[model samples]
Target: MKALLVIASLVASIMMTYAASPSLEKLQEGEKIKVRYTSQGCFHSSNYLMDFSPNKVSIYEFLDKKNKNPTKIGELTLSDGDTAGLDKLFAFYGNGKEKIGCTTVDNISITVIDKDGNTKATYHYNDGSGQAHRLEGVITLGEIVHRLRP
Candidate 1:
């Protein structure tokens, strides 16, 4: 009876962990994420973080194919005075081919700003294509979250 009880408790704990949504601690390295941020003009990047933690994430700018060692732009922190909530972060990446004469590639960074001129969150989107034209924008966290949510 004791053994059975222990097994049942362990099983219940495991189930609860699986059912729970990811918290800051569950975030892992190399895991892709969609983040949104607000700044002077909103910046978004799909290739945003080379490294991340619950407290801070390093930001990177999109690099041209020929440019070696992409520039390390800035860093975002969850505790940054400007940040308000988790709803602000977003990240995504995609690649496709265009029907035009050349390939189209778009690497984007998104950020949002409050009335006081503070950053909310930063997002990254790398949309690469085989066409020559590029389509990109810097949007709010609310916009991307709505578009991405099922």
Candidate 2:
């Protein structure tokens, strides 16, 4: 009886661990990641878009809230190093589902999608806090955008 109980506990532990971590390998070719940042105020607002793909990364500055017809401000080809960094970051993120409680004017959203357009993961956070702050300084999409940008 005790032996059976031990086996069951071990199985449960393994399942819990797996459920808490996201697998970077799941990101395949053509995967896309989009990040949107918006600053809202009484007088004016600003918007920015960051896109990451298997081979390219792009950043655009929008002139309106609708994000219509924007100018490409920066772009770069994805390097192996960038992929490695993302893998490390996602590994550190684990389940990647946590509410980042912050208070600031900047609103940020990140979305990851597969080649088939299936959503993989999404993160949303706001507050004047640094972009990487919510990630516990592991890494930030903002940093990736900056690197991709000129």
Local distance difference test values of all predictions, in order: 0.38, 0.63
| lDDT agreement of model 1 with the native | 0.38
* Candidate 1, superposed: residue stretches over 4 Å from native: 25-45, 61-71, 80-84, 87-150
lDDT of 2 by residue, 1-150 (tens): 999999999999877755543333345678887768776655646678877777567878797756799888888775666656655555544444452443436676668788899886676655443334345435445565556443
Candidate 1 lDDT, 42-130, residue by residue in tens: 25323322334445556543356543465666654545321223322221222222232323334445443333555534434543322
Q: Report per-prediction Cα RMSD to one decimal.
A: 13.5, 6.1
Model 2 — TM-score against the truth? Answer: 0.53
TM-score of each: 0.32, 0.53
- For model 2, the stretches where C-alpha displacement exceeds 4 angstroms are 1-26, 39-46, 80-105, 131-139, 144-150
